[model samples]
Target: MKITTLIENLKNDSQDLINESGLSLYIELDNKRILFDTGKTGSFITNAQKLGIHLEHVDAVVLSHGHHDHGGGLLPFFKVNSKAKVYMKRKAAGDYYFHILGFNKNIGIDKKVFEEYSNRIAYIDRFTEIMNEIYIITDIEEQDLTPRGNKYLFAKEGNKRVQDKFEHELMMVIKQQDGICVFTGCSHKGTPNMIRAARTIFPSLDIKAVIGGFHLMTIPMLKSFSASQEEIQAIAQMIVDENIQKVYTGHCTGVKAYKNLKHILGSKIEYIRTGSQIYV
Candidate 1:
């Protein structure tokens, strides 16, 4: 498997690619091309072109959640790829929002945008295999103590700001020669929860690595209003306990959170930025 960071929050100082508060990964596995998430703008497309990646040939596009930062590039992608099938949870079409400082903003995928390509979407509600060794995992069952930093995330239900259940959140797992590598979006449900869900699907494989945002990062506006120190430590320890060999995280996984994780996981944890590539 070969993975390229098409877009991320950081860029290699030597590379001229643009960076944003989003995530997009272009993955090649078993001679198949998969566009994981589309980041937040056309910057991903620009970077992919510079990297010589052709979007028209991607076999599939997997969306981990409904957050705009992850799916906002769909508009530009649709203009390029005419054949790639988009895989996402059915609930992603619902109203989702980010509530902060007494303000609620629509943070979900644009329903109107999805309607334009509805014929090409494969909205799923349960765990389903997209192809050989590739699967879209849902219904995550949390086996570890993952801090719920989702008090601000909500889904509208009859004029009520119901806390987001994260039903639209899904993960992708690839079975490799060594073990399984998990790809997540924001991990609003938590990385441990996603791992536990993956284990249930492929119980025999070791969780080799996890790549994406863990969402355990601190808020820039409300520095004192994030996951507790104890919670962060527990998550770091959970990765060690699970024997997850490596963790490549960025975007929402704040600098402070990465520092905490590095203190425990050391070199085992890698910061993924734009222009990063992982092979397994």
Candidate 2:
């Protein structure tokens, strides 16, 4: 199995949005081409073209969330690969809100944009095995994980917490001779919850490595967005608990937070910033 980042703040030899939140990753598995979330703008397309990716050949597409940064490129994608199958969580169609420091934002998307190919659309409310061993972990139950509603979280109708369910996120397990590799867009549903869910899905499978965005950009979420070094150290310990093999994170994961996580995860943390690639 091989995964190529088509869109990210990090570009290839081409010049594009270098600090953008949008990320498009091309994942190859089981002889099928799977397209992860389309980056915010058409940077995904430009990057792919510059890097020689044929968008028309993508077999399937997955959404990691309704955020503009993740969904903005889908419409344009349809204009090209109109026959590709699309998959995402059922709650993805629900109305979402985002309360910013100065304003309230409505970030909900229309179902038709993704559901037009009804015969090819598969909505997973919980979990679904897309192929023989590939699975899509839909929005996790908000029952136990931390509350998504926070000072930075936005909502609609008074801007309540939008339960993304990691709605657009999927946990891909690529079976290797000795272990499996798990890839995700962002663990908004919580990394611990994602790990546990993966364990339950394949009780005997061992996760070899982790790659993609981590969304550790906020202080409230990072434990040291703007605090002293002492607080950052505590945050590092929190990340070490996951025991994940290699952490190749980027996008919302800030430079400071990445450094802190690197200190804790040690050599296990394989950092991937803008324009970097991790081969597995």
Candidate 3:
């Protein structure tokens, strides 16, 4: 499989790419082109063009969650790629908010995109094999070590907003001959939990690599870390314990947290940026 970072929070060294507080990956696997996420805006489209990625020919699009930074490019994507079906968790259209400093800010995807492109969107509520060897896992029950940064996130239940359980988040697993590659958007549920869930589902397959954000940033505005050094070290230790071959993370995984992880994982971990590419 070949994966290219279409959009991310950082930029590749000396590369002409648009950087945003979002994540998007272009994947070529099993003769199919898959778009993992759309990033926060249509800016990723420009980055795709620069990288010589033809979005029009993309075969499938998988949204990692309901967050705007993950699925905000749906409108522009539908405008270009009319044939690809965009997949997301069933409740991904529900209202989501970020609560901080006594303020509630809407941070969910645009509901109109779901309404207008209803025919082109697929709502997934269970373990589904979207294509040969490509699977989407939505039932992540292992909640060990979920991100502390998620404390500020909430979702509407009725008239009241409650803490988000992150049921709207999903993980993508691509099963290859050697092992499986996991793709996550922000890992709001927790990276360790997601990995455990993936292992539970595919206990026979070795996890070759895990990719995407780990959501370790407490406050982006203040640039503070949510996970303590010990917590970050534990996560890094978990990765090492699991024997995960490689980890490509960025976006919500703060620089300090990444450094903390790097201190332990060393060459096993890498920080991905806009225009970054990986082959597995």
- Work out the TM-score per prediction: 0.94, 0.80, 0.97
Candidate 1 global lDDT: 0.85
On TM-score, the candidate that comes out on top is: 3
Residues 1-280, candidate 1: write the lDDT tens digits.
8889999888999998988888999999888999999998879999999999998899999999888889999989999989999999988878888787888788888776677889888997888899888989988876665545677788988888898988898999998888999998988887777877887788888998899988875452253336677767776876887888889988777667888889888998988889899875
36-115 in candidate 3: lDDT tens per residue?
99999999999999888899999999999999999999999988898999989889999999999898789999988978
Clashing pairs in 1: none
List runs of model 1 lying over 4 Å from the truth. Answer: 218-225
lDDT (tens digit, per residue) of candidate 2 on 254-275: 5666787777677877656434
- Which ranges of candidate 2 are over 4 A from the true structure? 12-19, 110-120, 139-151, 157-170, 219-243
TM-score of 3: 0.97
lDDT of each: 0.85, 0.62, 0.90
* Model 2 per-residue lDDT at 44: 76
Pick out the ten consecutive residues of candidate 1 with the lowest summed lDDT. 217-226
Give the better candidate number (1 or 3) by TM-score.
Answer: 3
The parts of candidate 3 lying over 4 Å away from their true place are: none
